[model samples]
Target: MTVKSKKYHISGERLEELQQIAEENMFMHASQLNDWRGKLNIFVKGEGVWVEDAKGKKYLDSLGGLWYKAAGYGRKEIADAVYNQMTQIESSPSGSATISQIELAGKIANLYPEKSSRSFFVSGGAEAVETAVKMAKKFSILNGKPGAYKVLSRRYSYHGGTAMAVSLGGAKTADPMGPTMPGAIHVTNWNSYRLPYSGDPVDVAIKCANEFEEVIKHQGPDTVAAIIAEPVSAAFGIQIPPQEYWQRLREIADKYDVLLIADEVITGFGRLGEYFGPMNWGVQPDITTVAKALTSGYAPLGAAIATKKVADAFTGGPEETFTHLITFGGHPSACAAALANLEIFEKEDLVGNSKKMGNYLFEKLLELKKYDIVGDVRGGLGLLAAVEFVADKKEKVAFPASAKLAQKLPKFLFDRNIVTFRAGDIISICPPLSITKNEIDYLVDAIEDSIIHLKKDLNT
Candidate 1:
């Protein structure tokens, strides 16, 4: 298979019309709108693991459209489901229950652990986080410990962009708005590669878990409502914690009586080869938030699943309502799309494929370490992996922030007809779960060639 050169271009009235739209009203996330207003590649279509720009140049969607789209693009099954649902009923208020919403919630409950059997729907990941946070606090209050309102989150973790979600997130980019929500505490992240202690992986994991315990102790466990974390830190460079890390954290949370909230927005729906991230680590969180692949990016939908114990707390009297709602929390069409997406996952054995392809991709990525610029290649649990670059691999020295290597690498790969994501110096490659071995090889080869070209261009 011959890879096409990046020579496609657009012009005339169509280009002008797009430029006007892009420049006039569109404000992209995490971007300098002024600088990127007109200087952006407009994607017109997507199919399988590839996407085409307005210029008709096709590129492999290695990041799965921001780590969603696990079932791949152009899924007509999901489209048809959404269409049929819209024909019947487009949406319903939170006060009312829709059939699609009820079915999706039940399906999600049955899919995850029995403990997390009740769910609250929301529009997206951020809203899910917001909902989870509020539930944790309210649960504490209802349980008679109103002081338990602080949330412990790890540094470099990203929950979402809402006020509460942003506060829970520890990423620098997630904090551009300056002040965060109150009572959001930060703790050490389980980045074994950059661990302060040098020892066995299990020992390092123990040490990391100890840090979390210490924070709870110092903050006074009685005052802490919950501990929110990603099973495999995705937005923060795919930081896969040691096997012992999650179990240890779960034990600590249980001991401290703190609710464990697993933000599986990126790790749920078989992205990690398991139904949920906590399941992948063999630890069930009290509350699990899911989005992204829940509907395989076919539609906007997210959910916060709570254990029966937690949900039961808000029940009893007729006046005992959760007291929160989102207008489109349970859109009938979105729920229908999600149901169809999960059906495809089961029929195609995409979860099993994620595990198999993830292993293959991990081994292929390890080959890149032979390059002087490649520092680390981590990720094997499932189809989520990353390639971290360094100016000095021996010392693990990162390039200066001003260099903006992370921002530049994506464009470089894009020019070579490969689409991946970058977080600072770490490049992430998470293709659709349905990707074939041939497609994986093409992605890895393109990444290698791009790194070689980048090193030469930088004279490194």
Candidate 2:
């Protein structure tokens, strides 16, 4: 369980060159720190749970390439699958009637809870969200509720980065952009730590469901078309709702006749110890959008799976077309990659691993709460968890935005050879489900050491 620092054998000059390349050419995400540019350690290779930087520094990949490398890095089978598919039918687009695309679509459709649901493939998560919104609206119209165009999303949940997805996202950071898509209504999310209601777990769940009903009634249910939610609330620190939330939410959606869209972009395909997050919560969605682990990020592929009821509403003669299409919607190579990825998940018993490892990680993280700087440690029984840092232990005071403490904490770990990041004030650990217990111990040690070091420096 111990991780000794390996010899970083590269010359200092070579390390400087890599740092300069990132500074000069890379366009970082909005969450990335500009000052940390020079501190960036360029990765050169990966195998299993370890990534080696250009400097030959080996780090445990706890973030798993934005939570996509579910099967772990340097998986030879994945590479072979992609290579074989590329050699066979590399360039067929969704626009054409191709066999690879057709077969892959069938494979994806089969993954849905409702076997009758159809799938519309796309390049990535954002595109999937965009397609889901479009489908929800179109389905609403076809069902004779043309005015129902609003999408209700939960606050602090992240959908994706596309305009429509960003609009659908209810996070604080997502709003700075002047104008997002209209009619994207947001309701309070079910994080008990932030909920206004003070009661038992079942009471809180009921209250949250009531809040959704209030939002619907206030907005007029006739005007609302769908309610999109991340079943496990993956982005906002992986907020796991209480037991009855899903059932109650489903009740609310059905009562209002609103299409329930589960955005499983981050929680599907073994991330939540289930095939889909919606299924994990025991609720059925009218439409489901998935990405991330769909192809384990080996290829860019996403799907919007529509339930039979939703599909049947549009199942007329040939004249009733979807009228929606992405040029590379069902790209042959992407489909091949996804099919292979699913096969790997099934063979590896990864879902079982996620459940066991998630429980182990959670138990370990609970020990972290003893540290004064760690305000909260939370997650579920899967390969997802987060530790939130705070300025004051007793008051739970968040570090000021000007200080940007959350960003600094992860960078500190990164510099110390642990790859991870944060969502808002919470630093998350969503390593590939294939990570071993020994790797988990290394990740925990890295964070533990970094926090002690950072706290000492801040006090001084």
lDDT for predicted candidate 2 compared with the true structure: 0.80
Q: What's the TM for model 1?
A: 0.95
The CA lDDT of each predicted structure is 0.85, 0.80
> Candidate 1 regions off by >4 Å?
1-11, 175-178, 401-404
Error of 2 at 247 (Å): 1.1
lDDT by residue (1-460, candidate 1, tens digit) is 2334344445568788888887888887777776567667787777899887766778899989988989999999999999999998787654677798889988998888773589899989999999998999889888877799899898888998788888888877553776777789888787756775789878987888788789889989878999999999977788888778989989998998888999999999888888887777689899999999999898999999999988988897754579888888867899999999999999999999999999999999999999998999998989999999898998999888876786778778877789765545888878999999999999999888888878887788
lDDT of 1 at 48: 94
> What range of 10 consecutive residues in model 2 has the weakest lDDT sum?
1-10
lDDT of 2 by residue, 95-187 (tens): 465565677667766766777778888888889998888888888888778899888887788988888888888878764778877898887
